[model samples]
Target: MRKIYVVGIGAGDPDHLTLQAAKAIGRTNVFFLLDKGEAKASLVELRERLIKHYGHPHKRIVEGRDPDRDRTPADYTGTVADWRHRRSLVLEELITEHLGDAEIGSILVWGDPSLYDSTIAILEEILERGAVDFEFEVVPGISSVSALAAKHRVGLNRVGQPFQITTGRRLAEGWPEGVDDVVVMLDAQHAFTKHPEADIYWGAYVSTPDELLACGPVAEVADEIVATRTEARERHGWIMDTYLLRRNR
Candidate 1:
């Protein structure tokens, strides 16, 4: 039987790699990568950098073209399901072609494997189809949410209170029920603009050299964030951001 390790490589900083994740990389025989295209080349470069630093000298690196999906779909859940299915197919093919018996393969996931990432789901989907056989494990890494909170020097929730982690689309719909602290990710729509009453601790490319941080009352800082996001996106061709919305209740 073959083995796969889904290792989390942290948000963006190289130093974010945990000792356990590094050990897993050192043990891997092959590194599977999905290229998200030219605009996101920096992401691919980061993965390669880690592999070169910690991977075995003769470790094989394989690449697969990531399936493209609609950024804004009327049916979000259905669209994501389809996209994930397509991605699973691509990964399944790569595994079958490149991964040898008894050899260890790895998928270096950004942030953490369990948070908002599709790699694990894709693997499970492939297994469910009975097309592949491999044992796998997840090595957790620092998430952008954690990095954002650390950079802002704030806690996610106040004393004795709970918090919610959600997407920008869900936040756009409305604030979640019963949660004064909301963490938002993947908000391409500038959804924070909808809640001018909340205080936002926002950061883009957290833990990276290009990191940007802003915080204040939404009414006061929303415009600044939007402008900064626009400029950064235009300059870099892509952006990954997360924010904590703390409402006064």
Candidate 2:
């Protein structure tokens, strides 16, 4: 039987790689890299840099692409189902080719595997098919939300209050009904513009030397975030950003 280790590399910084994640990388015989096409090539480069920095010689790197699909549709659930199906196919193909007998393979995920990541979903699909006998291990890394909070020197939630983490697409569709605090990720449309009540603390490329941060009332700085995000993305060729929004009562 083989094992697949899904290790979070954290957000764009080699130091963010946890000790356990580092060990997992070193132990794995093969490493699979997911390419999000040309728009996010920097992400692929960042992962490569971390691998080289750790000097892990036993690992062989293989590249894979996320399934191309129309993710924005009237039926969001159906769209995601199709996308997952495609991803599962790609992962299965990669595993069959590179995973030798008695070897462990690792996929370097961005941020923590538990947060808004689809690697596990793809793994589940592979498991459903019973194509390969394997066990999955998740090595957690510091999430961008934690990094954002740390950079701003603030807690993610207020005393006795709970916070919700969601994607920008959901936020744009509507505020999460009753959540007091929301942390948004993968927001390409600047969905903060939809809400006026919350205070926003936004950071782009948190923990990296080129990190950019902006914080203020949603109404006050929403445009700034949109403009900044656009300019930065244009300049850097890629951006992995996360933000926290607190609804003040």
Candidate 3:
């Protein structure tokens, strides 16, 4: 039977690639590349570079157009379900055509597959449709949450307390109750401004040369964070950021 490996390539930095991920890259017969449009084209370049350095020279690199996601849709759940359905179709085609019998296929995810990623879920959906028959394995790698904590030089949680990871939408709904440590991801808006008292440790373009970091009370640094994020996005044409917000710390 053909084997499909959902491989995590780490958060931007090649040095962070785990031994297992490197081995997966080396063994993969086909590495699937999902184009996320021009904004993240640089990321694809980085992935190609990684493949050149780690993967076998004669292995195939297959390209697929990822379904467009509505970042600011009115009906979030519906929009996501529609997108997932389209993605599943695309994956089905990739598996049926590009992946052959007894060949090792892989999709190199940006971060660990189990975190905020949907690749694994999409793969499961494709398999559940009863069209693709293959064994899939997930290879975990370092997530941006851990990378953010390390670069910020702070722990995700306080002593005897638990930390929560949420999206900007949830943070906008108001910070989760009973949690002092909140890590926010996929926040296009500066949701941290809603809480002026919280101390924020934020990082953007993490682990790259364009990396940016800011820390201080939300009130004091909100403008700075916003401006920096805007400038970085404008300059680079893209940005991937995450932050840890600690209330009453």
lDDT of 1 by residue, 1-249 (tens): 899999999999999999999999999999999999999999999999999999989999999999999988999899999999999998899999999999999999999999999988889999999989998999999999999999999999999999999999898899999999999999999999998998999999999899999999999999999999999999999999999999998
- Report the Cα lDDT for residue 32, model 2: 86
The worst-scoring run of ten residues by lDDT in candidate 2 lies at: 50-59
Count clashing pairs, candidate 1: 0
User: Which has the greatest lDDT?
Assistant: 1
Per-residue lDDT tens digits for candidate 2, residues 65-98, read 8777774579878988888888888889999988
**Per-residue lDDT of 218 in model 2:** 92
Report the candidate with higher TM-score, 2 versus 3: 3
Kindly give the stretch of ten consecutive residues in candidate 3 with the minimal lDDT sum. 203-212
lDDT string, candidate 3, 1-249, tens digits: 999888888888889889999999999899888898998898899889888999997799988898888888999989999998898898889889988999999888887899998888898898888887989999998898889899988999988999899999899999898899999998987899999998999999788777899999999999999999999889888789999999995
Model 3 sits at a Cα RMSD from the real structure of 1.1
- Could you tell me every candidate's TM-score relative to the true structure? 0.98, 0.92, 0.97
